[model samples]
Target: MGSCKDEDRNEINCLFVHGPIIIGAGPSGLAVAACLQENGVPSLILERSDCIASLWQQKTYDRLKLHLPKQFCQLPFLNFPKNFPKYPTKHQFVSYMESYAKHFSIEPKFKQSVLGAEFDNLTGFWMVKTQDFQYFSRWLIVATGENAEPVIPEIHGIEKFQGPVMHTSVYKSGSEFQKQRVLVVGCGNSGMEVSLDLCRYNASPHMVVRNSVHILPREMFGVSTFSVAMALLKWLPLGLVDKFLLMVANFTLGNTDRLGLRRPKTGPIELKNATGKSPVLDVGALSQIKAGKIKVVEGVKEITKNGAKFMDGQEREFDSIILATGYKSNVPSWLKGENGLYAVGFTRRGLLGTSSDAVKIARDVADQWSMINKIFPDIDTKLLK
Candidate 1:
């Protein structure tokens, strides 16, 4: 392998055609890259953003902390700095990701957006295509993650009334909405957190909650909820496990019944399905709703110039509307092949979605590649990195 040193930075050169190609530079992609590096694999990660973990930098709202504890959320070979808070804020998390990339020396090709990829059965490789470059790889890993595309709920006059309308993914801070009547649509973590942030900034915020959600503290009885989950999952069925979890959450954190929105008639009583699976447990936003800090309303049916009209015959006006709607997964769009391409992080696996999920995806990909590695001995373990 040929290495070039530019400004004391070790730049890796792509020497072989059969090396693995990993897409996306989020947690899952980065985790795979770090593991491959440790194994001396020469894999290349392609990221569209100018920096790694673009979603963490771009999409996360102000005052947002990891719903999961720090021990579970940190990626392999990289831990959050000790000086960091227990549950890292959005900025802190983004900073941790930057350090992770630098520590592993995972110098991803920045701004190299993958336009498309296709599997070539004849060549037994994936023909990877981007805006400026093209390559072929023996194995392709799609870790683009689930939040690449923002899910903007369809509402009448969304495009028509349009006064700086954008999804929660595009929202960076609440300082912009000072003294404005802000209508926060959705009651998920993002919705509640953003609404709370806006309230602190003196923005008259109202959360347009469509339904009820169960809230759980990140930690319970001085133990991480993540640890609690691992122990429980080993013995119980998913349905039974979900029931146990919800029961604990509702009893401890209070229910959302008094707010007009009723809990859905579902098995697990989960949040939205972003990454193939449901959110672990809801963090209580009902407190904010009941305290008159954030007004919870029914769903939005339409929108006018002043503001949005709700499904329950309510017309609420706002200076700005932050759509805490959700996100969409685009991992399938990266694979290039005629055969079955394995996708892991695009959906929920074993309950927890984005919370410490990259590690799980990395392990799954590792298992799949183990078989591939046996057949193709020429492919260096470094390529897996």
Candidate 2:
């Protein structure tokens, strides 16, 4: 609300936020800011990256698309363009994100990497320290979603590999690996899609299936599997819904076990609810696997000079390696929540959950804002600006 130099350090800049200070300018932060604006509550957004939705804009492959239907992925109080496909492309989704920020006037402080945020008991405010400024606010919102940072697991002798090895975050296209023997280490959605893309680019991709996973068709009976599951969940129980889904998957995609992909003991939806592991929605990858265009292999034991050694004692030579190990939240590393601090979008329920959290946080903050104004009528209104 106001800017002043820190008394102890005159060169350091400090600002007090009137409302909540939201971290991350991703979909989660934008949604929360828009909802707060709707409630007549202003917010300050701090982003480490220069643009909104940096993960989608900077870290995704060209072929990436929303795995679920548009409705499931959209933010609060806004709908995806009707012109866009059911599952919008990465570029299209990024464009929509930009439009959402513009429509809500949610301009965040870009490149403001937060060093740490702590609740100050003395002043009854949150002190957020960034690289250039110190921010104080009564409310703090951690909007950094689950995928704030990529998970890079250590592999034995990976540094000794003669070929280029990269994570999915830095991977863009399979054209770079054309005619090369590529080893994809992961069986998640990104891994599946990356392997398929490699096949399309005439690259030989061997996908490693390290663990049991649920593979479901993206669409079943001309309807989105996610939509069907949501509808079924209205009346049927989760266990029953999982059974129906598995039965249909078996009839449609055949047994994945024969292709080295084993089904997990826990049902798909139940497993997702328990652990945040999402079931892979096959997008032509299964067909390629069946046709021998994409080879499915076992877990990697170690990385060799040329390629990798599998846990099953098989050795293969690869020109490149792609790790689709996925991402996780970095909240624990920065903010320590207490007092007025809150966290949204870390529920593992995706965008739909984010929308819900945004609305709830806005309402709570609005109530507090109103009460503070009513009780402390003589307090400086400029301080609460």
Cα error, candidate 2, residue 235 (Å): 0.4
Task: Put down candidate 1 lDDT per residue, 44-103, tens digits, no spaces.
Answer: 888898888888787676667777667767777767788887777878888888888889
lDDT of each: 0.69, 0.93
TM-score of predicted model 2?
0.96
TM-score of each: 0.82, 0.96
Best model number under TM-score: 2
Clashes of each: 19, 1
Error of 2 at 290 (Å): 0.8
Model 1 / residue 269 / CA error / Å: 7.2
Q: After superposition, how far is residue 200 of candidate 1 from its true place, in Å?
A: 0.7
Off by over 4 Å in 1: 1-18, 235-244, 267-284, 332-340, 349-385
CA-only RMSD, every prediction: 6.3, 1.9
